[model samples]
Target: MPKIFSLFFLFVLLISCDEDVLPKPKAYLSLEYPKKSYKKLPLKRPYTFNVLKNTTIIDDKNNWLKIKYPTLKASIDITYRPIQNNMKELLTEAEKLVFKHAVKAEQIIPKDFVNTKNRVFGSLYEITGNAASQLQFHVTDSTHHFIKGSLYFYAKPNYDSILPAVAYIKSDILHLIETLEWKKSI
Candidate 1:
């Protein structure tokens, strides 16, 4: 009888110890972003004919506001400029900036027409590189306002690692386009 009681007590202790072993949470490749906290900032260039209200940022140096989701990350960069010298010249300058880091410009596709009361223009560009590929858009109110945007994804030298981020960032970019509104010129 004593031996059986001791065994029963030992079994209870073992069961209690097992109960203390909590399962570890699973690890995942994920990112988390805070709620949208957008702020407006001034542009150094006075040529900005119009600015987008929701797209403004406090600093031009850090052009894009970064957002991270559990499985992806994104950024939206907004720039506005009034029609200045020549439209072609301005576009050329913009192209130069985008292609600065590219080995070659793979393709350029027209995004959409920006038809406003004052102006009309379209946007387009696609660049491929050893490290990554970028889809760029150029917007113009035609007369005196031009805005250019690009979505760049980090990739390996072979252009493989960028796939995940690129897929997700594209959606964010589309969202930005859908929400864009022309604010007053600066």
Candidate 2:
């Protein structure tokens, strides 16, 4: 009788231990994203702006595309060719735009230019409002056969809010510049 009671107690202890040994609840880690969708708008000019096909616009007229990583809180603006048409003129126009908005603007040196697989690119810093953000632009006149590209994140005035998205979206910008197709002038 004593031996039987001891065995039953041991069996109960083993069952309790087994119940406690459940597989650690599956650990899951993921980023949170907003519900988003994009539509192709009719190109009003000869230029075409192609987004990731997954972006969403809070408004079409404002040209705001909800960024994929909301933590970055970013949007892309694809402005068509303004009056300035050539690369030189475009650069000058861009400089003017930056200076107009920035309390201070500085042109980066050649050492700052980063050589990627295809194009040479540099960043210009502009301090506007109370914060400073980067104005990074890359040009590939050789491939596109014409001067064409974009000024990005112009609406983002906060450096902290804009920098992360700028960094994340830069690869996409490089891809866009790499795969650019120029409309041949008839």
Highest-scoring model, lDDT: 1
For each candidate, the alpha-carbon lDDT, in order, equals 0.52, 0.43
Candidate number with greatest TM-score? 1
51-142 in candidate 2: lDDT tens per residue?
44455433334222232333454454444342334666666765565555455434332113444653434333324233333443434333
lDDT for model 1 comes to: 0.52
- Candidate 2: worst-modelled 10 consecutive residues by lDDT: 62-71
- For candidate 2, the C-alpha RMSD (Å) to the true structure equals 10.0
- Candidates' TM-scores? 0.51, 0.43
What lDDT does candidate 1 reach at residue 171? 50
Off by over 4 Å in 2: 1-50, 57-73, 82-88, 101-133, 136-156
lDDT, candidate 2, equals 0.43
- What is the Cα-based lDDT of residue 22 in candidate 1? 75
Model 1 poorest ten-residue lDDT run: 62-71
